[model samples]
Target: MKSKGNLWRVSTTVSQVAQPLPEDKSVDLVVIGGGFTGNSAALEAARRGASVAVLEARTVGHGGSGRNVGLVNAGLWIPPQEVIGIMGNAAGHKLMAALAEGPSRVWRIIEDAGIDCEATRNGTLHLAHSAAGVRNLQERHRQGAAMGWPVECLDAKETARRTGSLAFYGSLFDPRAGTIQPLSYARGLAAAAHEAGARLHDQTKVTRIRQLGDKWIIEANGFTVRARALLLATNAYFDGIEMGFRPEFVAVSYFQFATAPMPARLRESILPGGEGCWDTAVVMSSFRIDEAGRMIVGAVGDLDGPGRPIHAAWARRALSRVYPQLADLPFEHDWCGRIAMTADHIPKIVALGPNAYASFGYSGRGISPGTVFGTQAAIALLEADESVLPVAPVRTHRERLVRAKEVYYESGAVLTHALRPALF
Candidate 1:
């Protein structure tokens, strides 16, 4: 069968309404963008008894939040030490502590909200694609251990047994991480937020945002809103509204394909423990088995762009190289999402004048950081306490040569996908 649309959208059991924005209204806070961050912030704000409104340009989870690989991983892509080196010991440790608990925080929300997003806490495996990759994981394991993180490094034999494939050199298993139906998680958050008194409006595109005296003025879809605090959580899907400050980051695309449910016997051997996995290749690829036994694999490239054929072929080849038994299976669903990659691979919280902030640039790590950042940002804004933010808010952030970097990334993915002749 030809590829369907996004697998999460098709498989998600959770749902939310897309109500229109009410005009000429005012509230304590106005959140732009209705993905994980906005919905999360709105949820926290409303629960704290602050009047809040969320305006989503499109449907909830329409952006990266809906389109991710769903590996609710902890911490950023960079090493723990590197984060410390960049942000200093105190700040780094604070952010790391916050993110390291990200999975639990998410699970708590899921449990309290009773969100049924195929929630699994079985953990995740970071597969080593090569001997060098093994060394890299060893270093990561060491760093994690130094910080008292519960990370374990598995040998090649254990890795093979866990992955049901003899492709990896080794693997790093992080018990703190897991997987979920990402879109469902976002929708469930939105639903819970609405129930908690947050006014959420989808399909409401903001045309302009400006500071009017002490209040923030937002004009969207012929509607106006005045709020004491504002959060632009648009991330990679920013609509470029006439806001004075725009977040800067290179947009990189990641695509995923899912196969029809495998037979019980076959599925039982592959990822039987239900750990989501990703490899260490530069052009990284991720794989996992959903609750229904469907095998989903993802890689860093656009499946909807000119390199579609190249990426598709690479995906098939990569899958065969790892799990040759599943080579004959055809993908039944495919979709792509853009990532807001900062040069430093760190998320940013840009201060947008007084009582206003814009957050973006999670690189590829969204689920946890988005939740932590969103939740904390809400509390900080509502209480006028910036100290609660995980990352220090900056007055301005800029990325140079964003377009060129985007082209460079896409070209690299195309070239890499087009020509990796050896076994991975």
Candidate 2:
């Protein structure tokens, strides 16, 4: 799919690893997708001595993995207490504890691989946009602190000082979080996997997948490849392969606009602490600085179709509202992508067949969860032990009414963006 605007047109620094599928070949593990999850799984599996092959419909990281907000956050979109409430204490706690170290694990791999994606470990801020939002941040701080997380609640003044934006009432800072060039990071993983002896096939779309005897036959691009195990990491970009098991979720679109590199004087005053930020609004807004010092502001909306006008208007107003200093800053880039969201907002790992699994539904929180889940999935498949996985693989579940939900989300974003400036 073509991107909507220039935001995705910015050149990523990561070099693409070269490997395309042979006319006919077989591997121990077949990973369908070349994004973070698939590449991470391939890397882990290959490191464990399993022969792995990764198939990408496009180039590696061409999906949402390339167009993310770049915040390397450490937890799920749902709070800890709510997660426990939904999944029961034991299961939820297990998942939470495993993911609590997600950012560290991601950075360790980046450092060890010597991938230069401009990884910065400063931290992240969950900004509170209203009085109620402040209360929410307070609760998050308390819960995170109780769990031994390095989280601090900052008052409005402190938040403004750090962010250079008085648009928030308060903020929750978590030292466990950070940011990266998402596309470069994903490509880095692919490169590491390639170096670790995994074969990566770009522009090879998997058209049909079926079980042939005890082996899995995956047909793509006029060729067939057999594998002992298969892993489906195609989240929102999943086409028509019905594995008899799929994620129960909706596809919500999120758009981003990035300005050209700010003046050196203004860059120091804006996001000086090098933390990525997002506000606590129903229709949330995110702001962060890229490695090149470009200010990227994003929100939940469709960058394509007629709703583009609404999103464009809101983005302009939002930029002015946050930093009047950059009121006239020309937005040079704009892009959007889909996020898979489960009804309960938790990711799922579903067992589709013997030695086959599919993982999806990270909502908008992909970086950490994708790496953690992909790595664990590789271990589980290679070692024949699911004990190491953060979430247990299930056999089957009901798919959500995704079409209706997607329409609803887009409609809501369009309406909200159309009216946001007036309310402000």
Candidate 3:
């Protein structure tokens, strides 16, 4: 329902126009959902001189796009070999190579469009939580290097120096990765699309879509728009849309808490290299410092759910465990967002019909992949080509144990957080 928590609403301001849909209109393309994917698609299509319109059930960045962890990392959460294993050699390699350029594509767009979203292109650290975790990083580093990725496997001593915390055993640092103010970035894309002659309508919920003789008729709030092609980019916020497209993915929630800006001395000592970080634990946790010096920590669970207290307590303890100097500081803001977790943990581009597609399921890695998929999907539809696309479009995608998996993720996170002391 709600798009953002205190951090987004308080720290960022979106510049997109939310005019209601007109009584009747026609465009070369129509996009559903106004997150990064929809907005990026609209921007790409519009930039190519195609008339485009974007419909949003809620305000811009109202889903994972706005609430994301903002790690603009290359590739998926899994190793390159795992990706190749899942999609098979050809398709998986195509996807992998395509996404390897994700961070560059994202940052270039940000710079080219002048999107002021606090983008820091320093890099990211995939930390190892324990001795076993170090083994995982070694393998990831090896695979990444083999694939020509600029990855570095740091020893624990170097990890401590870079992170300013001794909690991690080692780290896998990818120089291609970076961070951004997610909500601001999404809005920036929307604004760029609008400037490029794309029409974006917010608070205009599309009730139904029916193909009408060479055109797609989209019935929204109080109007109908006819388009030659259609795109459904509503990653995790599809329930609000009435019909036509249903993406099957297990839902997982990720929550983040930001503390008040640290003192200059403390800030300099923490995350000295300014790289965002997440660990190798099964129930992983992330920590990073924003431009304003707030230390934002996040994990995989709904902070507003029944386990809110436990999640909050775990965050506090986790903070102390890593950086005890800031343990006395209080959290200034907290929020949560849902992730569309596919059965295989890969994003899907489902072909709805001729000239139509729905893209979803980025798991927790939404920023880079969402932007890449959105831009590429638009190009593929416009040019009637799939070669440039990451993965071949599927007619349908489903996850069988959706509800069960959702519960399992949250339960695992709660149990892990509740039993944090024993593990740490």
Candidate 4:
């Protein structure tokens, strides 16, 4: 069967209006790709009194931003201690401290902008799928406590009570985490940016970017736009722009399936604490409920291919295994998106030219990091200060075997979905 054109059809229904690009124009800043990073950067830059124009190949949030699982998690996928170990004390501490308030920043923006994205702040649960998983959670709990974070390690009984599933031995609960309707949130950002005086253009594909003397010239949709500065916020959807540098990362797919709204009684019993959750399986699985009582079960796979049935079946079985009461629920919506993963699982902001920068490689954690980094990037670019950035900008580097790693992740997803029962 042919795949659907838009994986996030449900979200597009209420999204903001898409503005057309100007025929020939110039702006202080031209942002490429209208995902979370682009929209957030545009909003911040405009708020800072800079003339900004955003060019999106499709609608806002058409990529991973729209297809995300909507978990507004604080920090990256790796724990704080692991981050410190990788980057040493000073740099790591900067990143950890900056991102520790990630979800708070995101929620504050949503509330201040009056975005109706089903925003929820009940918190998130990190379930342990195995004994080793439980041990890892314990270590994370300790590290989080040391940092004065509001994180708790729940025992098996408490975990079951919170998650409505006895399949896990233990879990980690973080009050800083929450969930949102990702597509709506993305569109809301675009709307807020527009309201803040940023010009947003949908279906405006940037074909080329080059530096002409002191200014950068952007060619898109049969027009040219000259800007004093440029921001390549494309992330995984980069289309070969000449930014003088590229992010060292590979794209991996993550998919989700949402069931029809469940009965109120059943919904109350399942995930009663209203926390978004993901387990510690090798090929991780996530579960959460929407305001409409729809159970969304997600895993790593391309849901728009021949493996759809396999992934769909695995989701059904996994849901049944975790919450037997809703075993018969039928999924109503299924979708997938690509996540940019770096070698060290860290996000990067590279300086491509005098006033040009490219930020990417979120490694499947976009919500809070995207907002925090984009906001900071706008401030740094406008004020010519790198001190406000979440992570130190990469001076210069080359990605080792990125193509091979991309293929490895895609092939691994296929094999994992093909052998679902055994693996799950």
Best by lDDT: 1
- TM-score of every prediction relative to native: 0.98, 0.96, 0.97, 0.95
Q: At residue 3, give the lDDT of candidate 4.
A: 30
Q: For each candidate, what is the lDDT?
A: 0.91, 0.86, 0.89, 0.84
Give a tens-digit lDDT track for model 2, residues 1-424: 2333645335677788945676887899999988889989999999989899899988898888988898999879878888889999899999999889999998999999988787999999999988999999999888888778888999999999999887889899988899998888889999999999999999898888889787989998889889998899988888776344445678888889888789999999899989999888888789999877888889998887789988988988888888889989888888888898888988999897888889898999989999999999988888878889898888875656778888888999899888766211
| Candidate ordering by lDDT (highest first) | 1, 3, 2, 4
Ten residues in sequence with the least summed lDDT for candidate 4: 1-10
Candidate 3 local lDDT, 176-287, one digit each (tens): 9989999999999999999999999988889989998989999997789999989999988887555556888888999998888999999988997789999899998898
Once fitted onto the true fold, the runs of candidate 3 whose alpha carbons sit more than 4 angstroms away are 1-4, 240-242, 422-424
Between candidates 1 and 2, name the one with more favorable TM-score. Answer: 1
Instruction: Single out the weakest 10-residue window by summed lDDT for candidate 2.
Output: 1-10
lDDT of 1 by residue, 1-424 (tens): 7778899999999877668886788999999999889989999998999999999988999999999889999999999999999989999999999999999999999999998899899999998999999999999999999999999999999998988999889999999999999999999999999999998899899999988899999999898999999999999998688977789999999998898898888987898899999888898889998888888989889887899999988888887888889999888999999999999898999999889999999999999999999999999999999999999999999999999999999999899988884234
The local lDDT score (0 to 100) that residue 20 gets in candidate 3 is 76
243 Cα displacement, candidate 4 (Å): 4.8
Quote the lDDT for 285 in model 4: 79
Shift of residue 49 alpha carbon in model 4, Å: 1.5
